[model samples]
Target: MVQKTFGIYTTTDTTAEEERLYVELGQRHIALWTAEETTRQILAFELFEHEMSPLDSLAEVLKQVKLFSRLLDNRYAKTQVIWENQECLLVPNSFHDREIAPNYLDLMFGNSVNTLVQEQQRPAEQMTAVFRIPRNWKDAAQQYFPGAAFEHKYLQLYYRFSNDPKGIYTLFYRSHFILILVKGFKVQLLQTFDYQTPEDALYHILNTCNQYKMDYDTTPVHVEGLIDLNSPMYEELKKYLRDVSTAEPSGEWQIGSEFAQHPPHYFLPFFKMMS
Candidate 1:
């Protein structure tokens, strides 16, 4: 798999943000750029940075994004923003089996009604994903990007990959990793973990495999995101699996020439959003 060194990228460019649609907001870094509204293809994109903390208001991130995005034009005219936060919960859509509990997340996170919580139901998939954007963040989004869509990053990847997965699929982010186990379109497991070292990440994947009775030695694994093909994490994974390869974004939008420069997997969720 190839690794995209996103940290080397800049925040946002003024004239460029005007031409396209959709932005990825993660870790106080705003990927502000445009995709063709008709084609939903990425035209040009740029990343913007602002200092932030878990406790800092998300408005700080929005403030910096507004400083760059709303310079002389209004993105709200046609463009939309997609927020990618990690805090989320997924519940199967078996209403008869379990009562829907929206407040369950608030207690888990120790936030109250002040949190901006939203849920999307993929009834065809029998799952409802509830995700959170900090209140300050939601307020900021509503102000500048009223048409914004909020989803947990994991859910975005989950729906896209789970539709027709085989063996194991993993998505590696800079901060953590997510795993989804599927056998012939049947999802057996969905999970996430935080890791500081390569071994920590390995342990979670291997342990999950063992628990699910997956043959770690033979199950083909597909992966995407910030992992390097020769990195210790990838090498260690290769030792356990018979086949491992970097996965490409599965759906379609007319890909722009500018997108050719970035790893295709880096924009998997963004493409999924547009699709």
Candidate 2:
């Protein structure tokens, strides 16, 4: 049997050993790997520092994520889109049991597109594009939003960006939940919270569900991040959000993992204001 495999490399967590552990856990599904470079070093700044533009920042991050997805789809064993951020990842699957297919990713960053692309045998669009956004941002996310009205509009989303290399500290704002609409693609809604305690975050999330009138409390939602499951944040998140399913956090796409894998990889090119 040809067991499918995929890899993640990022710097969300500073721990190096956790990568191997995450990989081991993932081995039940897809074979995992990591890059020697840290994803933290790839910092993108706004086009101009003239004003505080959170929306612009969010758009920039989306672009970066989209570009990264493009690169991943351009090359890979499986022609599928991959999405990553400091907190989690989401992969599209053709099978009912999404985990069985190597169609999604966890956290990991910092390998050249050229290298990853070299491994691709198919063209883009043959695979589904992965889309992920801040779950905590849904809370207190009104500031970056634009209103959209649709009957049974079950979801919402917002986007923002910043120069802060420390992605977590940039404010997930779990107090509010917002929805994002893609022209002809998919829609995303997320909740953001301040406290590191997962219980607190989960409480806020539940509240949002009530407000949205969606039955999410018992739903098995998926999540991902780079922090060790044994850590305070991880434990808290699991306890409070236990009802939801979570993906293995991608260390390969995060800053901490990137640094652990490679401290000196050049990331200046990837982090830039696209014209």
Candidate 3:
């Protein structure tokens, strides 16, 4: 089957119903993201082009604007045109200049800044992931929770492992543990720890989780690391966390999604808030 993709970026919650509207209009699966609650930031839209060209998908998107507008009015209790092509979509740039500086751009444009000044400015766009869940999971989601929402972020970690030539070497000798918070379809935090023992490493992990304001009451804690899965250090971490069940590889860091560049930018606002 051929899948068509389109992205909707809006200042308010107007684009929230675009996905269902498109699906009703004979459009295949579409991935959507919103920035409604983020303080100064407005919105970001990502459209994936798979089994079709970008131009055809773009046309299909243009054709569905009125239906999307009506859906937004009936569902989210708002009436507005939520889709704009040139405003939300970003043009490729080969310039090595300051346009690539995220921190500076975010300072000027993120949710913290006054939205009224640039209410006309559209949020930037990028290509992002669209998941195909297992059939059982999909059936459960549709049956019990039809109108539910799920949000996720992506992060990258860099670790260095030390090896020894001795017969009995140490497992926790030289590895830097990192935790990243992915938000707005980008990495927001990158925390690193240099601990001496497995206990210390585990402590750092727990402390980092404590510092992060996750939905712990309902959402599960997730950890990803580059360690020998069968090593003693891994066993100690499992024991320290009270069970080996919670200590597992992160699904986000699977084979296909490996980082292709040096590293990602840091989200300063989240850190200041964390501090």
Candidates in order, TM-scores: namely 0.77, 0.27, 0.26
Point out the higher-scoring one by lDDT: 1 or 2: 1
Taking all chains together, the TM-score of candidate 3 against the true structure is: 0.26
When summed lDDT is taken over every stretch of 10 residues in candidate 2, the lowest stretch is 21-30
lDDT of 3 by residue, 43-76 (tens): 4333332232222433344334424432223333
Give the TM-score ranking, best first: 1, 2, 3
Q: lDDT for model 1, on a 0 to 1 scale?
A: 0.63
lDDT of 2 by residue, 1-275 (tens): 12221123443433342221101111011112322232323211111111212222333333333343312222122111112122222222332233432223232332222111101111222223232333322221222222311111011111121111211111121222112212212323332334546565556656655664545544444333233335565466456544543333233343444234422222211111110
> Candidate 1, after superposition: displacement of residue 73 in Å?
5.2
* Model 3 weakest lDDT span, ten residues long: 153-162
| Model 2 / residue 116 / CA error / Å | 38
Give the residue spans of candidate 3 off by over 4 A.
Answer: 1-174, 182-188, 213-225, 242-275
RMSD of each: 5.1, 18.6, 19.0
User: How many clashes (backbone atoms < 3 Å, residues ≥3 apart in a chain or on different chains) does model 3 have?
Assistant: 8
**What are the Cα lDDT values of the candidates?**
0.63, 0.27, 0.30
Count of clashes in candidate 1: 6
Clash list (residue pairs), candidate 3: 39-111, 40-110, 40-111, 40-112, 41-110, 41-111, 153-182, 154-182
